[model samples]
Target chain A: MERVVTINLNGNAWQLDEAAYDALRAYLGAAEAGLKDNPDRAEILSDLEQAIADKCSVVLGPRKSVVSAGEMQAILKEMGPVTDSEGFAEGAAPKPPVDVEKRLYRLRQGAWFAGVCSGIGAFFKIDPTIVRVIFVIAALITQGAALLVYLVMMFVVPSAETSEEWAAAHGLPFNAQEIIDTAKKRFGEVAENQNRMWKSAQKPPREPKVNAFVSPVQKPAAGYGARMFAGVVASVCALAEAVIGLGVIFVVWSLFTTGAVLGVEAPDAWPLWGVIIGVVVASAFVTWPLRAARRAAFGALGYDAAGSEAAFSFFAFIFTVGGVWYAFQYWPAARDVIEPIWLWFRAIIAPGGF
Target chain B: MNPDEKFAPLRKGLLEFAILKVISGPAVYAADILARLQGTDFATQEGTLYPLLSRLRRDELVDYEWQESQAGPPRKYYRLTEMGRAHLDDLQAYWRGLNQTLDNLGTFGGA
Candidate 1:
């Protein structure tokens, strides 16, 4: 049985199947978009909803209480192309079309797996093979941490479905027919591969059959050695990210412990509150930038950044000011606490301390 | 150009006049107007009609009053305003002149 959703339209409650609801929502969205320039947009939208509700009531009876997907499709079709016939005034100046901004979308064409690397390559104007190679290296260095990251990315990043999305992914202007053809070709290849797999699965297991199925997938464009090197590099970068993460945690712990020790030693002189505040703020200054950098990196890897850098930067600025203020006011006291810790840290890292 | 494409703009231009005429005599619900226009050249969808009606209201050419409907929510009973009637008269005059010109210009013997 199909799932049904209850929707309130113009003070009437109507039950519609899930597909019908989705279609209705999309149709309304398109209508809204088309009415962007209209002054009484809300009033017209409500009127349209009322009309739709009346239509639904007329169709619904005892046997067919809920609107099916086919009925919803037909209803929307009856609504026609949601555009004003007398939209533009002849004397009015023509407004320039809004520019389409570049956005990150995973490329499906020439993709080995989920097109994550290809997406990243498109975003950065680099070769997809290079991205693949780097990912491999990172996975090796971080002991599969990079692989985990890739898996997460595959799920997170949206694949380019439309020609406009494909164009946006490549930071190009919308060229409809050509981009559509390319996307169709990519999907065709995928379908062909799936068909081959299905055919092979029906046959008895054989080495040559498996080879035949796999041969089409492998591209001869990138060298085997290059991919290996990329794997090493990707692993190394992943390792670096992990190390930096660990380093920040350690630093935070050490700062807090040192503040506690100093408070017990000289509670009055130490200004324990000031030291704690300073440490917290200063540590945030470091971590916030790191987080922003990570977001930028993700953006490069074809993930929507959601304009998070501004928020990160704002906090970073506030913390930096606070940190600097504390450093000036309590420099001597802070130095006294940190000097011993510095010596101890040096001694551990480089025995026979300088 | 295809006949449909060539006449689309003309039909659109005349739609407001046609609507004004439809409601000139009596306050008509939107669906009633659509029903009247069905199977005619000026036939359109709710998507197009609502916005056009709203624009007419904004221009003070048409006004609607809330009328409770037995079927669903309250409907907008639309009627042409005094200004809309005046505008319709001017448009009809212009249309008559165009028709006369077309009839007189028919059968061009020379290029």
Candidate 2:
């Protein structure tokens, strides 16, 4: 008896026996790993999938629907085994080759602290053990500053997601039999540990239901491009938050002590008066995006805010409504007060307009 | 050393030249290229050839397109690039020159 699972491939539904599904998943996973360095990877992978689907349709025929393990093996054979560039492999008939770009990316699959040592080892074509020793000595000489640098690099340097990247990081040709063999070995231990965690329900199982070839640890982090984009968003949000906070402080001080803001006289000077109300409204306007931006930062990490997010959503909602109401009310009063100031601003900013 | 081991790198080097030569005529998928190479001295395992194909692409010697096939998935139909054609021409000229030199060496002693 076999477990049959339904999967959607290129928008079509496929029912595959568990073992057959695992084999197919692994094959695709290997293809993905192999082509990661290719610029047109998405198109290549999709084309590969389409070809497989077309072949399976012919093999299975319209009458036969269930994809069997034997059929899967036949498909793999027909596609031809992905092996090393050189005919020989140290271990088993070489696993599929992933020709990743010759660049450094930390692999989390076998990492202890970070994949930095592994990446450095790969880039320089040295043993990772030697790199580790060098790091330790460097850290000792630098009074533990290297550890901080390591933390920065953890985010700065992208982690290896594919076998090819892993190989390239460790200074080996991406056509690596040993890396896959080690991955298979390390995967069993990881699966055992994860199985225990899965049984405990520590968090949702990270592994997809079908793929045996894709170890959870081999999952690629967001590319460096994506990380940099998120970093920029975070910095922009922080700057916006700071500017808003300062604006609020200055507005409060203006309402309490003086009749003006940025040297412009307020129409109503009291702490609870119209100008103060408008400033409060403007403060809420900034608060709305500040909370939303923090959520965007967490969204980049695949996380969501639990308790504080709900409060922020409510606060942002209220301010959005209040900000609109205050702006409408104050525009008439504010417009009159700003007429002379506008002329003064035009003289300073755009003498041409004046 | 095994004969196969001795011949592997020699075959591997020429396979790059071979792939460009075969695909230089008409665009073909990976399996098609392999099938053409079969029954030839440079026939290789699928595992071995993919990385070479990858290298060729990286070197800008080849480019591929996903052509819809009657079979399961869209096939990656590979063809030689401008650089690859120029490279293949150079390799052919080098081989012809080398073969002439080697043949002349044998004739110099025997004749």
Highest DockQ: which candidate?
1
Q: Write the per-residue lDDT of candidate 1 for residues A145-167, one digit (tens) a residue.
A: 67667754543465564334565
Q: Report the Cα RMSD per candidate.
A: 20.6, 20.6
Q: Please give me the DockQ of candidate 1 compared with the native complex.
A: 0.30
What's the TM-score of each model vs. the native?
A: 0.44, 0.40
Q: After superposition, how far is residue A233 of candidate 1 from its true place, in Å?
A: 24
* Residue A120 alpha-carbon offset, candidate 1, angstroms: 33
Model 2 spans with C-alpha error above 4 angstroms: A9-12, A30-51, A78-354, B1-5, B45-51, B65-76, B109-111
True contacts kept of each: 0.63, 0.37
A52-143, model 2: which lDDT tens digit per residue? 66567766767888887668657665665444333332323444444445776765545565567877776777888898899999988976
**Candidate 1 lDDT for residue A49:** 77
lDDT of each: 0.61, 0.60
